[model samples]
Target: MTKAQIRQTYDRIAHWYDLIEAIPEFLGVKILRRELLQRASGKVLEVAAGTGKNLRYYPKTCQITAADMSSAMLEIARSRADGLGLDITFLIMDAEALGLHDQSFDTVVSSLTLCTFPDPVAAILEMARVCRSNGRILLVEHGRSDRERLGRWQDRRAERHAARVGCHWNREPLKIVLKAGLKVIDARRAFFGIFHLIEAMS
Candidate 1:
């Protein structure tokens, strides 16, 4: 999908996105979120922070700035941050071409977003660009399953799935991260290799 189309898709689903994701969150995504976010420190920036789902998982000491292309999604995120009583900076921005200064954030984060980005590599590169040289880039993303049967299933339906939500679920998260030229410190996969937890440095 085009970037505008993707934004419109998220804007239209912003209200029900969380509701639809609740079951998966309960099963294991929530734990993964917590695990990935716990490592964040100092000034943090969360890209494509849909509905602020990760807001509560961040360390209270870290100042957070959440950015998303969909204004409607960001509105819901703001409410979540407010409910959590956290002072967070929110912005309507493009992940592939961030407006923030380079090396400004101590930790950069993104979750379940690589699949939806129009240019996943460019977006990952932007994360590295804005992140401090000494800081970490943490990602928790879903992708093609390692299980051949399931991976084939995902491959067959990937286009149809993306039509519904702009998520290319079969894309390889780790490869895209590597293509962005960041030095990967660690990488792990779960849920039949569909979920990737990655740590990297610029």
Candidate 2:
């Protein structure tokens, strides 16, 4: 989708996105929050930070820059940050083309966001680009199942699903990260095989 279209689509859905995604999304992000604390330090950037779900989980001393393609989503994020007294900067930005300078952040985070990117690989490459040499990238995503039967089902259904929801379900995110020249330092799977938590360093 064009950037404007993507932004408009997400903006239209912003108010209801959290409500509809509450159950699985909330649990999944909570898991990511715990994992992020272990790897994130200093300045951090959260790409596709819809509604700032990770805001409360961030350490108080660490600076956070949360960016999303949709300004509507960032609005909710800003209010939440204000209410919580968290010093997070919310920007309207596309993950595939981050405007930040090189090596701007110590940690880059993407929680349940990779699948929504039209070009996951490019988005990740941008994440790595903005991170310092030794900085880490933390990702939590739900992807195609590893089981043969379910994997085939996901393959068959993913395009249609993506067309409808703006999210792809069958991406191999670990492969994308490694191909982007980041080394995986930690990884975990959950939710009977659909969810993943990956930590990598550039």
Candidate 3:
């Protein structure tokens, strides 16, 4: 789907997005998010911050900015932040071409977003560009499984799955990060190697 189409799709489902993923969030995604975000510090920017799911995981001392391509999704995120009593800046912006200045943030983050981006590498590069030299980029992303059979099953249904939700579930998250030219600090996979927790230096 085109970026505009993806935005519209997300907007249409913004209200239900959290509920739809509740099972997985409860199962393990939430834990991964918390573990990955604890490293964030100083000026932090979360790209594609859908529904602000990561808001409560951040340290209270960090100044946070959350951005997404879909305004409707961002609105929900803003409300979530408000409910959490956390002051956060919310913006409607594309991850591939962020409007923020270069190297303006001490940490950059994104979660479960690479699958849906039209240009995942570009999005990662943008995250790197907005991050300071010594800054860290944290990610919690899901892709193909490590098990051959499960990966094959995902590949077979990848197109259909993407057609429904714009998520290319078969993409490789770690490879995309490397393609973006960031220096990898650490990378770990969980849940049959479908979910990746990656830390990188810009």
Candidate 2 Cα outliers beyond 4 Å, as residue runs: none
The TM-score leader among the candidates is 3
Predicted candidate 3 versus true structure: per-residue lDDT over 1-202, tens digit per residue: 8998899999999999999989778768899999999999999999999999999999889999999989989999988988999999988898999999999999999999999999999999999999999999999999999899999999999999999889999999999999989899999998888888999987
lDDT of 2 by residue, 124-161 (tens): 99999999999989888888877878889999999898
Error of 1 at 78 (Å): 0.8
**Model 2 weakest 10-residue run by lDDT:** 26-35
- Cα lDDT of model 3 overall? 0.94
Worst 10 residues of 3 by lDDT: 21-30
Candidates in order have lDDT scores of: 0.93, 0.85, 0.94
Residue 183 CA error for candidate 2 (Å)? 0.4
Model 1 per-residue lDDT tens digits across residues 1-202: 8999999988999999999989768767888999989999999999999899999998889999999999999999999888988999999999999999999999999999999898999999999999999899999989999899999999999999998878899999999988989899989988788888999998
- What are the candidates' C-alpha RMSDs? 0.9, 1.4, 0.7
Worst 10 residues of 1 by lDDT: 23-32
Question: How big is the positional error of residue 153 in model 3, measured in Å on the Cα after superposition?
Answer: 0.5
TM-score-based ranking: 3, 1, 2
